[model samples]
Target: MARRERPARVPPRWVVTGAWRVHRAIYRVSGGRVGLWRPKPGRWGTLRLTTTGRRSGQPRSVLLGYYEDGRNLVTMAMNGWGEGEPAWWLNLLANPEAEVEVRGGTRRVRGRAAEGEERERLWARWREIDTQLDELAALRSTRTAVVVLEPL
Candidate 1:
């Protein structure tokens, strides 16, 4: 009997990295004006997050979709729905201090991983906006990390 050939799977890491590269390029080439707007209707706004590289100790910026929760800004560390955590989240784990730009206003914030009930509450808000939250998360092996940035 002939063996069936399995379809090739593109590594999620490469996909996520490539996406960030393109996104950063766009943000940069646009002179900080474009790519600063919120996402589509029913979705959250976007923010520019700058985190210190854990190993290199350099600044790294990435645009992330975010929602305002009271005095905190909440974002997911899914790395574009990849199987691994985003680098920014890792940086936050190493050092929770970071800077974020929302609506052209920059602020220092302390990042924290929401746990237990807090996480569920924030995740539920995301689900309200993104109906595919669970479906997208199912693609990854680890549970998604919900990060809350508290202004300092």
Candidate 2:
């Protein structure tokens, strides 16, 4: 039997952006007590990432979903499964150095786009986490970047 593919299920752009804003607001209101989590055996985790703004030279923070690959953390530079790259990702591209706050503690790290075999392996891992990863990725015109955050 031939296999069939399902269309990607993504929310409206405004709804997606609004959700991110609300999550950040909750994190701020709770004084960092909530909104962050650690990756589990079969699930991804949320982390608060702080990067230096490329043009402003100031700190900028965003929440990202990641999984552990040895001591390194891996995430995708997807903008709510939207068209353009996210601002946080652009900032990281300008200055690879950044900080991340996880459930147990914080870490200073350097970010880079995964490539070649590294990207394939990491992206496969993400596919395990999100079965629709490829479908969602197809929504964007440009290729989504698999980001690796290595400890500094």
Candidate 3:
């Protein structure tokens, strides 16, 4: 019998490009109708947040994974921190005011950073949902943050 080769667990950089292209395409085609589907019992919701670009201060689109922790939406600046605080988080650091669209409505919110015990707890849950995060941690450092969406 011949031996079979296994592929790398993570997609190549170019494949990430393609996946993002598809994501954008679906966002447009469905007017976000076929996109941003939130699975039950976890923080898999796609938060459509508009923030000023950290450098440009121009409006930017950020679609990040979110978990509901009581009254707040919990997420870290990293996907287990592949690239360190994503641009979106940087933007919030520069300007805390931003707009967020979730499920069916849009609202304005104030961004908050999380650390110590609180951050540790939320991140623990994150790791639980996606075990792949542990492997990625070896490649880079990850920062955690919690954004509070004030009801309008």
- Which segments of model 2 are wrong by more than 4 Å? 1-6
What does candidate 2's lDDT look like per residue over 58-101, in tens digits? 99999999999999999999999888889999999999999999
What does candidate 2 score on TM?
0.94
The TM-score-based order of candidates, best leading, equals 2, 1, 3
Off by over 4 Å in 1: 1-19, 39-41
lDDT of 1 by residue, 54-136 (tens): 99999988899898888899999987776678889999999899999887689999999899999999999999997668877
Leading candidate by lDDT: 2
Task: Output the lDDT of residue 43, model 2.
Answer: 89
- Number of the candidate with higher TM-score, 1 or 3: 1
TM-score of each: 0.84, 0.94, 0.79
lDDT score, residue 14, model 2? 91
Q: List the global CA lDDT of all models.
A: 0.86, 0.94, 0.69
RMSD (Cα, Å) of model 2: 2.3
Better of 1 and 2 by TM-score: 2
Residue 23 deviation, candidate 1, in Å? Answer: 2.8
Best by TM-score: 2
- Candidate 3 weakest ten by summed lDDT: 143-152
Q: Could you tell me which residue pairs clash in candidate 2?
A: none
